[model samples]
Target chain A: MIKIETCLTPEILSLHQLEGKIAVVTDVLRATSCMVAGLNAGVNSVIPVIKVEEALEYQKKGFITAGERGGVKVEEFTIGNSPFEHMQEEYHGKDICMTTTNGTVAITEAKKTAKEVIIGALLNVGTVAEYLKEQNQDIVIICAGWKGNPSLEDTLFAGALIHRLQDQAELTDDASFMALAQYQQANGKVADVIQNYASHAKRLSGLKAKSDLSFCAQEDYCSILPILNGEAITIKKN
Target chain B: MIKIETCLTPEILSLHQLEGKIAVVTDVLRATSCMVAGLNAGVNSVIPVIKVEEALEYQKKGFITAGERGGVKVEEFTIGNSPFEHMQEEYHGKDICMTTTNGTVAITEAKKTAKEVIIGALLNVGTVAEYLKEQNQDIVIICAGWKGNPSLEDTLFAGALIHRLQDQAELTDDASFMALAQYQQANGKVADVIQNYASHAKRLSGLKAKSDLSFCAQEDYCSILPILNGEAITIKKN
Candidate 1:
């Protein structure tokens, strides 16, 4: 397996290395978690845009805008960058033009290398892993950190994914080995293990995100694989 | 004060975003630590170069070439990337052209933004911190990680430096907070804290770089400040 790894610090995620392979975009704190929740709640599609201007342009093309900055929803957008917002009745069958500080940027970057893209969060870690195993292809998981730097939390999620992919794929990258070793040392207690990630703790501290952390922390919360083909996120459902 | 905070992923050290500050290149591994030792042992100047070829070129220009790859001295270079190699009597008063995988790249990047460039490692952390504290200028600490990704060790060092300077400046970035928290949590217990840094440990195992780690981990080993001027590193004397 050709597994290459890159830490998705928010800025790096703004544009991922789309050189090759299937890209797994992971934003455990809010964005991908929100995407999972949105799809689970029956949203039709998520159109990711990096800039608010692009999101507005998507809205002009008859899409619904959903976003939050510093955890607050943009005034005109339909949703904040929260899974809590995704659990509502209004999103069913709606095309979501989603933008956030990190998640969307990561999606844009992942689109560069990924012929096939999958959204990864702790919420769907199991399904994502199982689906990747079924596909049996070279895969790259890009962790979208809070900003332009690698936050410990994103690396932890990358570690978790690497841990799951062990035995199924050959690891060649140093970061891959490090992630696997870290995940192994944690011994599957991902929640407590990830507490070392200060950004995760900080993002979850004072908002509805505190509870969302548990939601994201739950393993295999959904069996559905939300894959990105062309431009929209849809479930594998098979 | 302008406090630019960067993470220490081995990869990030090479992929730096340095702009407008005095750049402080940090490699908790062996490069900066070795550079500090070399300067302490009375080496007149240390030239930081990215490519081995550049070091060779510098050697042709009447400079001593000192460098290593994967812990062993490169076949063509005169020195290994070790603090001990740097302390050799032959290096005293000699201008040394040095290169390494990650730290040198970061120093190069920081050069673009910093008015002054300095090297910091665990061995010189206290001295660097004290110098920054006294200089009263906006400072940036670029952690040269093992490769290009964040390492717990380097971030811990960044946090340590930030903690020392936290009273002097407001951390205006998430990178600052992340480093601060990491440093606060992992202070003093360096070995246990960085045990999850499997890649680094494995590289050290291959290189038998234990002494380098031990010396790098030493507190206050060097009193001199290795500053980057033009293209070479020079001692900012007491």
Candidate 2:
């Protein structure tokens, strides 16, 4: 059976809970969504780092780097953490290095436990679902809630995943049933998710992250699987 | 206008946010629930402190002090954070000094920002609702999310308060919509909240808080509002 666990915050999750599962890392606001967009636009591989300084260090090595602080893309980086930035022809078959506040921390943390960590967002939910269905071990859909708390969007994404995976998986109460109901009630309205979820609204109201939000919400925009391979995220080679 | 904000976690809520709102301290798993239960059962007042040692110190004043560590009540103390414990007629109409892990920290934090702090949970939704709706300024509904990030239950409670006060106020992107979604989805499922939203769930589950879980789900179990007066949570005079 596919076993599922949900963590309200990233800080409290254990490697033991993640051990050997095909972990799916989601930070739907922009990080994971941006990564997927870049890959789909033809970037060769994306490297995710936890710190701004770390991503900056790679810039000299010819890696196009992206950095974010407090949701807005840092202006000094190779790109801001916007999915729109990734959807460019120049990015095709290129190497992109990224650093984000919450997404990268969660990705790094999940790497320590799971044998494999897969990135998911609405952009690639079906792909993740299909990928997990083929995998034999249990699956953990990790919601990288903002600042380690349950942000509305992250939980909604998890709820969406759970909704799809219900028949084939067992869910933990650590995942809120209410989250699933809300996402369902919205009828998977991508627009509503953008407007109603916490971080998305914050981004919209504060940062003019409309394109990023719209791009981030684009369901199944890419089927390219970005898997964690020791300290970085890379698209799986078929 | 009435307002409610979800703190989302027991940690990381800048105690600074408590600056000017009506703080509603909620810990449905037990803390605030037990405090409310204690009030209904006749405890004169609850002196909330951040540390257990402080709770112990109050015992010297000839007060019936209560303490809890993970979730269960402490030994030697007259009560753990439990509503059932609060039902004791012997404890009614007498002062009870109290300390618990997350809830107390939350109360202490909000005390700094709020004009007045009140205890809230699903158990006292309507009364809290009526109280908030009458307010004209921004009211902050603080949920002591487990250990400093948004928990499922707290956000839902915040959402319930927001839903109740929707017509009377506006919510920041940080909480209202996000929290509203979570509450709508969870719909007062106690088991789901503990398992999904709370960071300290496994520990609480280990402590057998499952029963506490059900008991805490009852809406407005008591109408006695535990209003924070100066440094104490006392029955709201209505």
Candidate 3:
């Protein structure tokens, strides 16, 4: 019997039973999307660091530093959190160290006990779901919400994943059902739904990151499955 | 400049900015509904206590003790958490001390800094919304989710309230908008939607508390507005 659950934010990660479960971490607005883009573009392993200083240290070791604090590029880092930034040919074949306000923190925390931690986002949700279905483990979808509050984009992405996997998985909690309902409510217009409704998308719009928002909202545009290998997130080459 | 926000659960209560705000607490499964029902039935006051011992002490001081843990009436208590129990004639004109698994704890926490705190549920949502509009203060709808996780019924109730209040109030965050969308999706079938979809409702059904679930799901069945007066929750006589 495989049960599926969702932890809406990182704050409630500790409450969910995670031992031996597969944790799919999503920060759809940027972090996980950026990871998917980077890994899909042929980057080497992407190290998810928690602090800006750690990313800077990785820069010193010849790895590209990429992160954001309040939706803007961190100072002295080579790349911003925008998925579009990782699509360049120069970024291909390079090692990238990434950090963000929510996504990396969630991944770091989920790595504590999850037997396997896989990065998920709108761009690669289908790939991630298929891989998880094959793994046949109890899955916990951890949404990296803004700060400590739930984010609509992450929840929507979780719903999209659940919609893909519901046939084989039991919806174990209300949050899962709620997310799937929201996803079904806005099916086929996910980008428009999220762009018009998500708080993070609105915030980025205020910062004039419309292109980044559109880039992140594209569904199934990438096929890379970034899985946590020890301390680094690298693409699973099938 | 009146902003409306929502705290989905007590776990994320700290992340929301609640100072100088009128906090509306909703525990629709039975706590807030029970409070609304008791106050409507003419109870002088309903004191919300966090611990069972506090309710027991209140019972010793000539107040009716009411609460539930694990959705059952606490041993020797005057009543369990069913709103139906509070609608009886004997509960009229009396002071009641209440505690519960999620609702009372959220109310106790909201009392710490909210300029004013009000209890809300599907039973009194219309009245609560009208009063909030009249107050013209920033509002935060705090949902008393099961333990630390977000519950479907509470979120749906929050959405119902948001649907009523969105015309005049600013939907301040992503959560507020998400909730309103949900309410709109389940517009006329709020009860059916919750009963069929809410995890708590299913749990209670498994416990054969379908009657309690139905009682809690009725919209606008009561007219009382439960507001925090100092430390006790009493009816607003407007």
For all candidates in order, the CA lDDT equals 0.72, 0.73, 0.88
Off by over 4 Å in 2: A8-22, A51-53, A69-76, A112-114, A136-140, A144-150, A176-178, A196-199, A205-211, B50-53, B145-152, B186-215
Question: lDDT per residue, candidate 3, A29-92, as tens digits?
Answer: 8999989988888788789989999999999999998989978899899989888787678988
For every model in order, what is the iRMS? Answer: 5.9, 5.0, 1.1
Better candidate by TM-score, 1 or 3: 3
The per-model DockQ list reads: 0.20, 0.27, 0.77
Q: Find the candidate with the highest TM-score and give its number.
A: 3
Candidate 3 on B1-238: residue-level lDDT in tens? 4578988889999988778999999999989988888788777899999999989999999999999998889997999988778878998999999999999999999999999999999999999888988888999999999988888889888898888877788887877877876777786888898888888877785444787788788888977788999889988886
Q: Native-vs-model 1 lDDT? A: 0.72
lDDT of 1 by residue, A13-92 (tens): 33335555778888777788888888887888888888888888888888888887766778878667768778688878
Models sorted by DockQ, best on top = 3, 2, 1
User: Candidate 2 DockQ category?
Assistant: acceptable
Superposition error at A48 for model 1 (Å): 2.7
Q: TM per model?
A: 0.75, 0.85, 0.97
Candidate 1 Cα outliers beyond 4 Å, as residue runs: A1-6, A10-22, A49-62, A68-80, A126-139, A151-156, A159-223, B1-4, B9-20, B50-61, B68-76, B151-153, B159-172, B176-220, B229-232
Native-to-model Cα distance after best TM-score fit, residue B139 in candidate 2, in Å: 3.3
